[model samples]
Target: MAGNQEPLSPRARLAVTAGRAAAAVSRAAGRGSGSVIGGKVALRLDPDLLAQLANHLDVVLVSATNGKTTTTRLIAEALRANGGVVSNALGANMPAGITSALAGGSDARYGVIEVDEKYLDTVARDVTPKAIALLNLSRDQLDRAAETRMLAERWREALSGTKAVVIANADDPLVVWAASSAPNVVWVAAGQEWKDDAWSCPACGGVMQRPGDDWFCGECGFRRPVPSWALSGDEVLDPHGSAWPIKLQLPGRANKANATTSAAVAAAFGVPPQTALERMHSVTAVAGRYDVVGYRGREVRLLLAKNPAGWLETFSLIDAPPAPVILSVNARSADGTDTSWLWDVDYSRLAGHPICVIGDRKLDLAVRLEVAGVDFQVCESAAEAVTACPPGRIEAIANYTAFQDLRRVVGN
Candidate 1:
């Protein structure tokens, strides 16, 4: 439809039409956005629909354990400086949802895709992206997704000798190893705050040696690559040794790292660093993340953290003590059914803060908090949690489904 270069077969056209109809029905029924279900119906009718829809547009796939949606949003915004860009702005990173997004943006010249960590290879094989951004990989949805090393190995295999420019995070050992096999790579020192999953080398399975910010494997010769783009404090240094300040409206160092990666990917698409950063700065919130809403006469900021690495980054983003904190968790199918990852998060960080816990898995979180010697109140809902806190700005951090639940409750 949008890329009319090579016409779709009659069956493919029918599949697209059917998918749109299903999506509209779903929306009318108030089930959900209908992207995933629509894409599923389309793909079931035409299994090759994704490749067909992606044929004419330049595609860029962003994949990681965390930050996929935000980075994809930033990249899409930056690429808009060049031309029309279509993306799954919702947190859907699987093939079905991706197909729905591409089909919907038929007039877009570029497609920026946010791919789930495990689905990266599958999406890449289909879309034949112009560039791939490999951000840091850590343990996430372990019950459903493969281990970090296994995922990295798959990525390395998928990217071997790829024609697409691979923009990778050099600071992430697993990411470096995965992109090592790619023929074209642009390394960026985006920084990794959580290193629990990357302590061993993906190449040799040997203990990794980290001396300051650099990492290497003594058992094997694997090591961190010298990045062409590096983030230092609040500025990003381009390959030309030019430093550009990362002035994004997004909060936390994690977002700064994401912004840096976004700038590099934008550069690959011919957008100047300054222009891309300028465009990115306009993005205040991403898919309800960092959205501050008034609730119970208190400002509640929504933050999503799905795994250990994500929780680590989220801890840094929360407002300090007096602001109060609400932590919510759920182990629904969308979120991994395994709640064991709770043990890995350092809930002790909220030691001095007024803490409130809610969600389906509040008991699990409460136990973890109790073990950490943190004071917290178990609440049945976000409203109760907010009511327990003093009237002021409140930070609400939640896991996948819990975050969505909180968003609905807050009407954001």
Candidate 2:
């Protein structure tokens, strides 16, 4: 067990063993990582297995529409400086997978959990985390995950009177509203690139006014809180007016924002900003995300972008024009059924690039690209897409399942 914590009940112990066995079986059967299935089996046998496994460790729950996995990984690495830390580094973020991760890391001193947006409250209530990182929330899986405001309201209701220290994104109005009720909060000015979902105030349901980077609700007094930590250009400014350059192996401003929030969360756990940032710099990729692999004799960089906000951030991370871009999308269960959010992305930015579209939802993407006045060719597979482009370095952006498919094809 972790530290000097009490031992789990015999039933919980049995549940953990069963979960691990099930996970092994799943892996042997050529299934996925089996974290979720293992978790489900454990929960079925002992519904309170998660609480038992998490009781001994200092837990940090990270939730966001984007960067949850990367931020969780970064926080875990930073916390490792203090002692042993465990996390769902594979991005299996639901309750089942989270439970599996905790059960597997029962001996670790710290638990850094990447939680699904919808399951944050449920997981937090069970785990009783020491710190919670609320990154920016945007429109994601609208058909399944509900609207952003509703999710924020749930977070607000769940976080009210909580004992955990909330490290929230101050620049994101939705995140501000969600973490405002928490007793202790460390606010970070993590920039929000996709403002399409946050136009209305979550507090007053009034139109939000944004002049420059600041935002306030005119109808209500709710506004962007003064952040203790702010990201200015390429550097992150701490509360004491000291600036630290964010030189992470990860790319884009979204990742920089995630790193900033991770540093704050780590600081809450008694780690210094310098140490946390230094540990985070070694993380080159999250799961298969941001991995550059060879395909059809070309170096292809893989980027995952599920929703509009994710797509917007991914676009900034890709190589510039003349490098060619491969856009892939899928309407799998993991990726919400409705592909309407495709229209929300600004694909016009890739106008100059030799764009190739592939995946289950490539036709829908092609239609959207046509409306955006961007030229694109439909492809059957990632291999086909890569071969079509000129041999050199190329960028491949994909949604959930499509990214997995591309990884399989690229053998990453």
Q: Candidate 1 at residue 92, lDDT?
A: 72
lDDT (Cα, tens digit) per residue for candidate 1, span 1-412:
1355377899889989999999999999998999999999999999999999999889999999889899999999999998898899997789999999988777788999999888889999998999999998898887888988889999999999888999999999999999999999999999999999999888888999999998999998899899999998999899999999998999999999999999999999899999999999999999999999998889889999999999999999876677799999999998989999999999888899989999999999999999999998999888888899898789999999999999999864
lDDT of 2 by residue, 1-412 (tens): 2464578899998998999999999999989888999999999999998888888999999999998999999999999989898898898999999989888776689999999999999999999999999998888886788788889999999999999999999989999999999999999998988898899989889999999999999998799899999888888899999998887999888888888898889888789989999999899988989898887789989899999999998888766688899999999999998999998899998989999999998999999999999989999988889999998999999999999989999965
| Candidate 1 lDDT score at position 59 | 93
Model 1 weakest 10-residue run by lDDT: 1-10
Q: Model 2 off-target regions past 4 Å?
A: none
Q: Predict model 2's lDDT versus the native.
A: 0.90
Off by over 4 Å in 1: 1-4
